[model samples]
Target: MDARKVEKITALLISAMIVCLSFSGEWDWQTVGIYAGSNMPERLLYPFFHTNMFHALLNSWCLLSIIFIYDIGIGRLLSAYMIAVTVPVDTLGYFTTMDSPTVGLSGLVFALFGSISFEVLRKRYYQLWMLFYLVAGFLFPGINAVLHLWCYVLGLIMALLNKPVKIMHHER
Candidate 1:
């Protein structure tokens, strides 16, 4: 399978899982924290749990859109990098807060904002778009605006420090 195709399929599967979570009503906000927190045995485990239907739907939409965009506009590696940054930040939020349950892919969305900002900085295009992302990050309600801000900052740092590399480039 082509890498891009795999990514698209993964995005769709994730979105499907989100829809399932929306209907399951099994995992609550606190339960999601347990799976996504820093104390986890592995970071890969966090993406499985969610808070509610709304949370799942919001994250699913954002993840699918971002992955789709990154896969096309940037590359598969960058899309994976965005997801990598997002998961840790999502977990970190759980660890940092005391009884404050964190859920959703808002952190990843913020990371996308950061990545886009980096692209703008590198290419000198989309200044207005970046500004709009910042505005959206701040203005969006019920979406961890603070986490988004921090993740954006972190993503900027990652983009600056790390050289772009293509991962999963070969077809499976």
Candidate 2:
């Protein structure tokens, strides 16, 4: 499939899931939120839902930008997204003192950003921006900085492990 099609489809599907699930009350804290002792299903599904349309749209925009800009392959995009969502929940869910359910694709967005940062290390802004965002998120209310950090690390590791080759072309 074309990269453009994959990017559009991924973004559309994610936005659709958030919108459709929002109407069904799946965003309710008790229903689909991730927390310590939550079932596996809740941990897996919460990332596809969000607290509000604005939250969903913000995440969607970040997701779209990363995939389109990097031209991330479908396999890499899906694998990273799933890992970003579930891994942080399992690892960090036990450590949080939150009174509400956590939801959003910020982790996935950060993961992609991290991957891009690793793939193109000369562009230092990605790492710097991630650090700035993490600090900002920590100071903000209701933001999960730890999860973002974890996802970013996971993405960097993914890039390191894959070590994708970039073929350079020179004009004759």
Candidate 3:
């Protein structure tokens, strides 16, 4: 199968996961934090929980959309970069705010914002898409808004420092 086909399937699967999660109907913020936290002394095969079905579904949808767009526009490398950068940043946020107990994909969304900034800068052209992304970033509200902005700035820097690759070569 082609890369595009693979990406489409991935997007669909992620979206489906989000939709299914939304209907699970289990919510617990503190338990989720303990499960997903980075400071796990014990080795558990699975260590993550959700505040509620809606929370999982919402995050899954956000993640799926970000992955879909990243695959479509940039390719898997940058998508991986975004995810790599996002996890640490988000984990830091969670640890720092352990008292608050936060759980969501806002961090990943912020990573997407970072990816977008990179795209806009590298292309040297700000089209409607960039504007839409900027607006979306500004309008979206969550504890990680600042984190998203910081990651975006960092991503832009990463993109700028990295040499450009031929996107057309991978085009189907």
Best by lDDT: 2
Model 3 lDDT per residue over 70-120, tens place: 544436434533453334534555434434444554444455555555454
Q: lDDT scores for all predictions? A: 0.58, 0.75, 0.50
Off by over 4 Å in 3: 34-37, 40-99, 118-142, 163-172
Candidate 2, residue 31: Cα displacement in angstroms equals 1.7
With candidate 2 superimposed using the best TM-score fit, by how many Å does residue 60's alpha carbon deviate from the native?
0.7
Q: On a 0 to 1 TM-score scale, where does candidate 2 land against the true structure?
A: 0.82
Better model by lDDT: candidate 1 vs candidate 3: 1
* lDDT, candidate 2, 34-114, per-residue tens: 776778788777787788778877887888777666768777787777876576455676665566777788887878876
Q: Is candidate 1 or candidate 2 better by TM-score?
A: 2
TM per candidate: 0.62, 0.82, 0.53
- Model 1 residue 72 CA deviation in Å: 7.0
Q: Count the backbone clashes (under 3 Å) in each candidate.
A: 0, 0, 3
